[model samples]
Target chain A: MAAAAHEPEVIRDKAVMRAWSRCRRAEGKAVALVPTMGFLHDGHLSLVSAAVAAAAGPVAVVVSIYVNPSQFAPTEDLATYPSDFAGDLRKLAATGAVAAVFCPPDLYVRGRAGHPAAGASGGAVSCLEDAGGHAHETWIRVEQLEKGLCGSSRPVFFRGVATVVSKLFNIVEPDIAVFGKKDYQQWRVICRMVRDLDFAIEIVGTEIVREADGLAMSSRNVHLSCEEREKALSISRSLMNARTAVLNGNNHGQQLKDEIVQTLKEAGGQVDYVEFQSLTFSLD
Target chain B: MAAAAHEPEVIRDKAVMRAWSRCRRAEGKAVALVPTMGFLHDGHLSLVSAAVAAAAGPVAVVVSIYVNPSQFAPTEDLATYPSDFAGDLRKLAATGAVAAVFCPPDLYVRGRAGHPAAGASGGAVSCLEDAGGHAHETWIRVEQLEKGLCGSSRPVFFRGVATVVSKLFNIVEPDIAVFGKKDYQQWRVICRMVRDLDFAIEIVGTEIVREADGLAMSSRNVHLSCEEREKALSISRSLMNARTAVLNGNNHGQQLKDEIVQTLKEAGGQVDYVEFQSLTFSLD
Candidate 1:
């Protein structure tokens, strides 16, 4: 707790971050990780808080602020992804729970050791071409689970997410990691990656944080016009109504999903999907 | 040195293997890993010797003996792959360089937990289905590197190698790992994976050990007839001739490759390929 009162030490080098975690573990302190893509909102901070609360005893919380480029398709908003490093640091500092801030400029850049044999580059390369020259080509895929939901639209997204998170897990070596449930498929894909790959880390999913009017918190919310923002509220409202319906013994999956879709369209929003999944993420 | 006099402890559980490495690291001892598929040969033991020599100081060398199922295609020899657990232990014991033997029964099983939402399984699933029910869906691929050469003939091999080696790296947390140059592409793929994925470990590729009669030692050699085995000698013989040819200024890639292929065919052997690759694995 004493360490948290001040701003967390920012770590740019991967080695420094790893060493810090190793040193803390040697002192019998548990390390918890909260991975984020900068521009922290309440949802991201809630994950930080959840990491602290989830620990058995005293814990060192590391918040990584990286907008991983691998998860974005070339046509996606890689260039315009929201960011505020100074504000993010301020927000993390205000929480008084973070022990360190890992803000690497690029995790995909080849290190001092060059890889000339990386072969002629092609196939699902990380979206960002390193300004230093050379693309990172190693990829992690969760096969079947990465095929539906957001994956259908953003084909390369989960591979990017899984690969970057794998790097963070290796670099931080956290005993536990916290993820916001708002990115539902992503959280499950990560869980499956950890499970299937035998990473010795526990994954904790925290609830979605919303504004008072019930719009899910997202850094990209800044890009929306006032009219668009109001229309988005229909999604959360219909979800709440559907939840009420389900609890009131109207638990039919299709009927409930149809209601949410109707509500969103009536509010002038194009619906992509409104699916109900089981605890294990099988579409019900 | 004291450990070399006794048989190494065989570790079956993944968690136990991780804990052993952790405890050793906490005491300031470095750990080295040599991953194998359990049919030990002199070629394998040489790797252990190399692992010991490669260490900067006294190191705890762990040899993992798991024939990873994920890297095999359905038509490949997952079921028929050779095994000699007791004999492997004796051979490793004879070397006296090993500190532990990690021989897990299954790394891809769903652990103590279940994964019912793994979705309808299809697409490059691991060759082995878990008797316990759930299939392991997570896979790692070194996209570009895992193509051509052996990867062309055995498409799933390098993916299996990369993924399982990743599991071993995570479980063993070795300070350095020794791989036989006999698996040239595999060693390079791992090095690339370490760099691309930011694994904080050193990779050492050891020279391939061969039999006195000039046959490259392989477990599959047992299945060959005596006459067939005699014919197989042409492959290594031709390779040696090619090396001599290159050293003697006959370095034309196509001309040298043609000599080896012609020799193999004349000796009643099938020529797959005789490639010249750069240190970084770029085919000449």
Candidate 2:
């Protein structure tokens, strides 16, 4: 409601975003940046809404819709990543409090207008071969948080995520940023990185949005077959079962994870990993 | 010579430094930061001088003297690392142009006054164990540059270096920062990090200053035995020989490396590694 009357500005350049954020900062206004890999869903809208709620008044909500390449492994879904810019902007606008949508083509690559980093801007994107031949090599990592959970399977995942998020924080200089709890580990990683680096940015975690049947909303959810989608319900059901078990005083982590693994297995689902980090979102 | 008339201020508080920098920014004054691990040798003084030279008109030169903990491994010399705070300050004062000397006891460790970052300032150093039990876990890494050279041997070395350097940059916000080329690989890593991260600070590399005998100046040079010191000269001599071989168009890489290894071996030095990467300081 604080930003209800504000019209959202669509920005493509990092300099423009910075200048915009700077103007907001000079006006003593708080800026909240919601960084997403696009393909927006109800879950992303929830995060954008949370970003809006994080500040009292004079808030600038900028949602970045760049598909960060660094977070994906060479063999992962980067090439197959989904995008619907028109829909994403429409959803962002529906949030009412959103003030800007940053849809840079590239945010972390050596080529394109994405962030104009990697190589100096104004140079042709094709000059990557002449401008040192590989993607930008700097990385930011939260060693402890990235060590467990999804990090064990995808070693480069958190590194890429942390680096790009760091770049965004630098570019926007946001007063607050929001991440969905569905990405519990990633949310924690971002929070720890911000605290450790003394960025003076507050990281807020928005609750996960779920389907009516309790399937956690994800862009990757589009990849599941109809039968696989049915099987996926077991994953959520297992978490709910674990929560119920914990409520009944079954605090043993290994036992809870074993139960979840067995439940998923019985439901015709394959578990890539079943880790229990902290009783925190190690559960999520 | 411009700094000759200005007395340096010793600031331990990050807030004070930021306020001072903000004041400088308002006055259109340029600032140069010289980051050092501070056993303050003539080499570090040269870096300070270079930082001073990098800026024109009104300039503020800041030299950070904290011995960063993240850069040292557990088995490395962190515990026994030498510190001569009084002597270091004397040398920093001798630089004449330095506007501030930031010598926090702990920068990467959450426990010490090292920037008083993790918790609010004016708190006792004892707050670390109670505040947070572990060392800071966030790291900044240069993917390509850190893969070779000293990095191959000390895997965690550059991550620690990069993270601490990044923290320093954020804390000081200097207009220009200087790295000495005695550490050519590290210099490159810092340059790449600054460029890739979109840090507006200008990164300048000062020429390596060496002793009359040609051994590069280093804080660790104090730890070498007389016999080992002479043996180390073979390492430099071998490099000079390899340079001559390259200039003579004997471009066989292995032959040149073997020549250096053999020369060091003959001089009672053990070669830990021999590598060639982009003609950079892959040997460092």
Candidate 3:
């Protein structure tokens, strides 16, 4: 069959999506979704590349552009998460992506409209406690994947990721979804979720895209100062060192972790966390 | 504006949904979705009624027909739940439903493949621990709503409802999705989920449609014995008594619960749970 046409790039609402599906059925084309938060970097591009390669037919890569508020902690840089829609679109186009950017607001808060009680407007918002009746009491909790690593530091982070990713998977309805492996825990958690929920879409974890100096490309990289950027290279370097150690028969979990932590500290990098567990076997 | 032509109901795969979106935009019509499992009843019909009433243009009620395994507990009757596609379609047609049912086994199982060792044979399994990895790892936790009523008896019930409902919402992409309040907690949880997740679609909760004798129409009602059917009337009767007590200046929480429990027992019915909580002035 001939390849499907890729004229319509941006689909905002559900109606457009339905029509898109109808046309694809006529052409026997497949869609690949690359969900992102709009600040497209090399890491995101890597996911797009993976999506393009994995799709069997004409691909429709939907990059959801919303910087989800639920995923961010109150103390985190939610308000200042970098967003470059124009730049993101140009980057996506450069990759020959037949992708639509879906960007929505952070808060779609709705109520019967009687306003808040008194002057409680400008207080420090406790995201967990203040959710009160405002947030849907329902939350997606991924057990083992969420208990360690980033979940240790940011308690609510994976819950937010699981929920948002679930929403995107539902909205985009892609044959395959590409996620960068740099957020290894997130990728694992999402994979677990997809398997648990039985979302038909195949989740492809793209290899970590790196900078010239070997630092993993992250949106948060923009937050690092010149010196911090130089120091951040240690994080990737430490992982490489750990990998080398594992290859050289250093299979002891604690030994590999200790070596990586020592290397990072030596390189002037603040160690967030460094731990090793058997890849195939359960830690417990 | 003229009403858009209703497209013939077509079951589109994940790849097709994207293409369908683009085609609809070209045709100048928005898509509205109403999601339902097969085995249609008045409860589901009520949601379709709401969807048709709220839709602006060509509406597509993508009835996802899948008996989701992740939602059922091991002890619950997952195998026995009713499913009738022909009968459901007939009902859909009566409700002016314009779209095809988006039934996919994997779509129904969205978020369920946590245990890699379990493999593909894990079909239609319950959330029992021994059922292995195909058993649900992620659950939608609803706080207060899950504290009383049916939740007490069926611990995994609302979680299953929320997860499946979420999957349906994502797959259908409705502008206005309808839900029947027969599953009152389900309706409330979904409303909260849509708001919390910033889903653009409007959630319309339809009032419960009951049998002539007042027992809520449920797919499980088919499993009830003739004698059990007569006994089930006590559930509604107990609810009515509780409502009457609250209306008669019964402000004490314990007293209201006690009265409801007593009324149910007096009517030769097993009391699952009776709970009372202060209704927020603002939520009202």
Candidate 4:
């Protein structure tokens, strides 16, 4: 209860974060970690609220704000991923839900202790380059879960996600963790990874948060031109239409996807993928 | 310390080991982990003693006994690898220097919670196959370090070692880890992995242990025939000669290797490799 009202601690280094978290854990506090690429939209904040609701018995909610470079392709928006560290902290502080904020400066740029053999270049290699690029050696993958859907279009996406999440889990050592179902496939990938790796942490998947216009909240939405933004609305709108149709006894899977695709295509949207499955995505 | 006098606890599950280690860590007790495949030898016990000697201020020493199959090549000796669980426990008990033994049944099998998408196979496939061999998608590699020495002959060796050790680090949550220099390349690979990954633990490399006959003690030594074992002694004999040559100021790298190669050749021993480098082996 004190943590909810207390001003959340701002931690920049992983070492400080670990010491803080470990101390709280020793006090029998149940910690829930919310990992985010920050630029606090309503979506990220809603995840915090979900963590709060899920928190029980001396719970401390911690949110990590990191724009992981490994997750973005060189041509993709690595340079453009939004950030406002002061703004994020202010918003998190306003919520009165977070107990601590973990904002590591260089999550991907590992230690500068260059391999003496690497000479001038050191061991600081780009993680995504050829095998010789970076010295980073560990990765976690949920094979089947990362294969379908956005996986095909963004091949390196889930590998980057899983690797970073695994590091976060190791760094934070939280008892419970929260992720958004908006990135539905990612949620499944993470859940499967946690289960397979025996991480001993509970994973909570929060529902998607949307604006009054029914568009899902995302930091990237801010960069869209007005016309492009209107067209982007079709993406979420199509999902809503399919859900309504299914609720109205339209149990035909192919027919539902066909209708949604048509609506998105009319709005000049490219439907990358559409999938429906049981919540857990159990392979058996 | 009380830990040094008490009989070492034998832990078979990952969950229990984590909780036990976490509790001690929270109490400010440092933990030193030594991971090994079972069938303990004096070399293994020496690793334990190093861990004990290095542990400071309420130390807990943990040794994980798991024969990781993923590290062995299919044609190599996975089935023939030695195991004596009871004998290993007895040896560790005799040391009175170990606090716990973590012997998991399946270090690489992962969870049986099969994914539904993999058709009939689910996630039950073996960890080492072609690209589509199994559903396990995680791996750790120390590119430059794994390239030389036995790594060239045994390509999958370092990958398997890095992965399983990473898992053990996550599971045991030790403060310090000790490795043997007898596994010279393996030691370097692990050091690079820990540094590159920012594991937040100290790695101590212990001196290589040898028998009175100058044979390096290994679990696999049990499989050698008497004549074969006698020839094996030549391997160490050449190494001791090489060391003496270097110490006696034989600075010519090529000349020393040429002489050593001829010695092993005369003894009817096929030398796998001979590497001389600065300790770090940076490939700049």
Candidate 5:
């Protein structure tokens, strides 16, 4: 725990990161992973602490800070996504929980070794064709879980998330991984993925960290004006109200979803969707 | 070489297989993998031998024998696929190359721990939902490479191949994997997948193993009648003719394909497809 306060090593190469994890594993030490985009916030740090606490024995924590391009669509904020490499490092260092920062500039390096463009720096091309007419064509998908939520609007979102996470799991080779439940579907999709793929690592889902004023902490919160931020509060409020309603014996899923959608619309929020899938849905 | 002649230990559990490979790795030994769908022929043995020859140092060769159900469709011959586990083991033992055989009855268990069906033995459900309403939803796809050849006819084939192979790689943690070029498109798809996914393992594609009559060795060959077997000879002959034509100044891709198709048709062989993809296509 004392070594956790030191400056974390920033690993830019995939091989180096993998070797670091492998070395830790070889030493009979557990490696905990917290995957994130660069602009680290309290929610991200909470996931890091969650990873640290979740480890049973002495553990080496790795925080991957790549802003994965595969998880973003062309129309999305991929180009405009906020980043602060230096600030992120300082934040992680402040957490006193992280051991290393795996800030690989590009995880999706095209055509490494086998293809025609083997050594060329074909960096971070999405699942689509790169400028060189070549592409990183392999993708991982969680078919059933990825559907209905964000998958409906962002057709390529879950595929991107699943693929990049698979890359991280393979490279980091962590004993356990932590994900924030703010992105509920993503966390479930990943849990399903690790299970289906037979990844030996355990998946830890942590609760979403929210601001004192009740808004969930997100990097995109920086983009919102005060008025927009106030309007976004309705999302958490409606969810709390729905929970209260469910506790009060109003157990209809569709009715709660309709109420939440109406609440968001009334609060001047543009509601893309409001879905409720039963967590207790029996597989049997 | 003495270790090679010892009977290969059969491994069925995923955890045990991972432990076997990890222990070998910890001892500074390389583990090579040869994946097959049972009913092993000389072709599969050749691949096991190639894995032995490919290693620079002492290596533990692992062969996985599973008839993956995800790659086959409901309309396809999933149930009818040939399998001979006992015979396959004898053939591999005779080769004196394989160190271990990973023959898991099912890799796609519906849920291990996170799902409602945890520890329920919901075995080997394809991408589709099972009778218990649970499924293994995760899948891997080599998009561009899988598009043209067998992918065209069997839409789910390469995704199945890519996904299952990924499971094997994660479980076996092999230093290198040997794939036979008899499934030419499959080999290419897997190579592309390993490159794109940043898997540390190496993929070695071995040449197609042919019988004395020049027919590619396949498990399905047992189903062929004498006349059907004679007609199948046209496939390898046409490929040889096309190669000869290419060497003799017939560099036109489509022209060679047309000639091959014509030859197969003339020999009363029903041609599903005859096409060419230039392996030398420059990514630049």
Candidate 6:
């Protein structure tokens, strides 16, 4: 299929989603979803490509472009996160994505209840509400996968991801959903969630898309200064170097992790975490 | 719409559900879900009735007939719980339900990879696994709501209810889901969950169906001896008396709660708990 050029229309209402789902059902087409927080990069596009390839007929790629406030930590950069609807639309159009972009902030964040009138618009704003009288704070916990790496640093991160992804899964009712392997643990956690929850959707993990110099493509990549951009390449490079060492008969898991940590530390990046485990994890 | 008496076709696969959903979509029917552990009682029937009334068009009443082992406390009954599928189907048939009974063993449980024999059925046979390759024993935590009443006594209870309800929500995708008010705290927790998670489905709290002598109907009521059955009626009587007192300008929450506890204590039944919160609580 040739990719379209113009921006796709955006849809916000649940009634519209149900109507769209009905239309797709009549056409005997299976829907596919690629959920993102909408600072669309090549990595997200790779996931979209995977979803398209896996689906049977005219694929409805429901790109949920919401920066969920619940996922961010108190000190995390939720307020400064970048979003570009026009640019994101242009990229999705080029990918020949069928149907509209689901760019509903209030719908995605607050559900049927409209977004609270906080009176801040057109720029970065804090979406945190006081814990008082806010009834629903229950979270989905993915036991082992959420205890290490990014999870240790950002505690409530995966809870927010699980909840929002769940909402998207219900809203889109996708046959297949895609995730980037760059967020390795996140992908694994979601896979476990789908299996545990018995969601019929297939989860496809795509390899991380990288810049020419091997820095992982991220919306947060924009936050880094030029010097930090160069420094971040060391993360992927260090992983590569560690892989080589393990392949050369260095089979000790702790030693491999330490080597990766040391290599990253030498490259002038603060180490978040480096751990290794058997890759035999599967969706049964 | 006239309620008919007929056996609804049972569907177990995703393809069948897709076809059914598509057919319903074509007919523009709204579905209502009534989730239960399936030892059919008057309370459960009341929920089915509520679902039938709330749904528009050809209402699909999905009665999940699994005795969800996850929700039961180890000290409580998990092994010898009553299950009568053939009888339950007959009861559902009487409701004129276009219901699909999802009866899968380990079908919803996530099993260990490479261990195909693990979690093979949806019954009491599967072991819950965490990421660490160890057994998962943790339960869902619903901060303050779980502190009083049943939560304090049955620690793992609401977690099991929440998780299983979440699974049911995904599987059924109902427009409105019904729950009996017999388990008042369970209904409250589920309402909190739907509100917190931003689920698009409506949660309807059906009034507690009772016997002629004011005994709340329950599957467990079958386990109670004739003497225990007599003792159970006192709990409901106390609740009604408390309600009457509150209606007569008694605003003191603690005093009302204490009265109910004293009444239950005077009778033969053990007092689990009695709580009074603001009227803001509803199945939103």
Query: For this target, which candidate reaches the highest TM-score against the unseen true structure?
Result: 1
Instruction: Give fnat for candidates 1, 2 and onward, in order.
Output: 0.78, 0.63, 0.53, 0.22, 0.81, 0.28
Best model number under DockQ: 1
lDDT of each: 0.83, 0.76, 0.65, 0.77, 0.82, 0.69
Q: Using lDDT as the measure, name the better of candidate 2 and candidate 3.
A: 2
Candidate 4 local distance difference test against the native: 0.77
List model 2 lDDT by residue over A19-100, tens digit each. 8987887777899999998899999988878887888887888999888766765557777888888888777777687888
Better of 1 and 5 by DockQ: 1
True contacts kept of 3: 0.53
lDDT at A33, model 1? 95
Candidate 1 lDDT over A1-284, as tens digits, reads 45445679999999999999998998899999999999999999999989989999989999999988777766788889999999999899998889999999988855333433332222443455322345577888887788787877777788889999999998999999999989999999999999888888999999999999999999999999999999999999999998887778775677788889999999999877778777224323
Off by more than 4 A, model 3: A1-31, A83-99, A107-133, A276-284, B1-127, B130-135, B142-147, B167-180, B194-213, B217-261, B273-284
C-alpha lDDT of residue B109 in model 5: 65
Give the Cα-based TM-score of candidate 5 against the true structure.
Answer: 0.89
User: Which stretches in model 2 have alpha-carbon errors above 4 Å?
Assistant: A1-5, A109-133, A222-238, A241-245, A248-267, A273-277, A280-284, B1-5, B13-23, B73-81, B109-134, B212-215, B223-284
Candidate topping lDDT: 1
lDDT of 3 by residue, A1-284 (tens): 74334322766765465456446645666777777887889888888778888987776666667776656666877778898888887787777765566665542343233433121111223244333424344456676678777877776678777877776655555678888877889998999887665566789998888888898888878889998888777788888887786678665776667777887888786777876645424221
TM-score per candidate: 0.91, 0.77, 0.68, 0.86, 0.89, 0.84
Query: How would you encode candidate 1's per-residue C-alpha lDDT over B43-152 as one tens digit per residue?
Result: 88988988898888878899999987767776877789889999999998888789899998888755333443342122444465332345577778887788788977
Q: TM-score of the candidate numbered 6?
A: 0.84
Which pairs, if any, clash in model 5?
none
Compared with the true structure, what per-residue lDDT tens digits does model 6 show for residues B1-284? Answer: 75354676666664465456546645777777788787898788888888888876667777776676666654677778887888888887877764666655543443455443322111222223311132332223444465567877776567777877877676666778898877888988888777666566899998878889998777878888988788788888988897887688666677777778887888765766666655413211
Task: Mark the 10 consecutive residues where model 4 chain B has the least summed lDDT.
Answer: B117-126
Q: lDDT per residue, candidate 5, A34-124, as tens digits?
A: 9999788899999988898899998999999888776775568887889888899889888777889998878775443434421111132
User: Using TM-score as the measure, what is the rank order of every candidate, best first?
Assistant: 1, 5, 4, 6, 2, 3
DockQ of each: 0.56, 0.31, 0.28, 0.31, 0.46, 0.27
Provide chain B's TM-score, model 4: 0.87
iRMSD (Å) of candidate 6? 8.1
Q: Which wins on DockQ, candidate 4 or candidate 5?
A: 5
